[model samples]
Target: MREARPLPQYLVQRYHGWRATAFVENRVWYRRLADDGQHPRAMVIACCDSRVHVTSIFGADTGEFFIHRNIANLVPPYAPDGEQHGTSAAVEYAVNTLKVAHIVVVGHTNCGGVQGCHAMCSGHAPELEEKSSFVGRWMDILRPGYERVTPLPPEQQIRELERQAVLISLENLMTFPFVKMAVESGNLSLHGVLHDIAEGMLEQYDHQAGGFAPIV
Candidate 1:
């Protein structure tokens, strides 16, 4: 086994500071959470982009939201091929085990993964089309979304594709039997949100309106 190295000084200092402040200040709350385990009411599937802060977006406290982050916040269609499905696994656990009432798939503007998918589909990123590229394979999930938005102007395609990522995930969530049953029974609700990284604005998908509208 490879030997593990010590954490960097900056991270160690940050940990110490957090431990001394937030951890110490909320010792009892933290202890209660540790003892009882988390029972978050909502599950947020968000992009792996560091700029998209799930907790901060909702002003959520620790243990309040079950979050899963992945490239472009995409969720592949339900496939039981007996292979590892990290995103699907998280969705199953959140819906079946945690019994979360809401599942929110959050996408963001200026997503690198989405841009890469656009490039690959547009034949601008031939390297990602290689068989060995994990990103290329994983990005197959967004191909349908990209196809649907292909008619738009070049400048608008990527941004629309980003929103489609959220919509696609929300649709894919229903592919899971448990997720479908929960939604059908009115026990679960699915939401799609797009975050504007530049303006720090949030737009929510309105089923009735059939498009995203800025939240106030």
Candidate 2:
């Protein structure tokens, strides 16, 4: 096996500083969490964008949320084929093993993944259409979302597609039999959220209203 390179000095220093402060401030809580396995009540599926800070937005504590990050925060339709599926694996563990009470699919404004999907679908990004592109394949999950938002003007398409990403994920999550059963039996609930990075605002999809409403 090849030896791994050491972390950069700056990152090492920052980690040490954070570790000291975190342990000093919440020693007991951290210890208890280590002793007892995590029992998070919610599973947050969020985009892999650095600007989208799920824990910070919710002020969540350690062991509070079981988080899964992927391109566009997409949850593809439930596929039971004997294939390697990272997102499905996470969903299964969170829903069946962890038994989370809630699942939140969080998308954000100016998402690169969503934009890439839009570009690919619109025949603007030919490079992403290749079979060898992992990103292209991953972004395919948002293709359906892009199609739904195509009717709007080009200027308004991106934001709408971003919101659609969350909605698509929420809808796809229910395709899992366990998720459907849980929701029907009142054991689980699903939510879709869109975060605006520039405005620091959140919009939640209202199933009853059939639209995204800003969080006041």
Put down candidate 1 lDDT per residue, 60-176, tens digits, no spaces: 999999999999999999999999999999999999999999999999999999999999999999989999999999998999999999999988999999999999998898899
Enumerate clash totals for all models, in the order shown.
0, 0
TM-score of each: 0.98, 0.97
Clashing pairs in 1: none
| C-alpha lDDT of all candidate models, in order | 0.95, 0.94
- Against the true structure, whose TM-score is highest? 1
lDDT for 187 in candidate 2 is 96
Positional deviation of 154 in candidate 2, in angstroms?
1.0
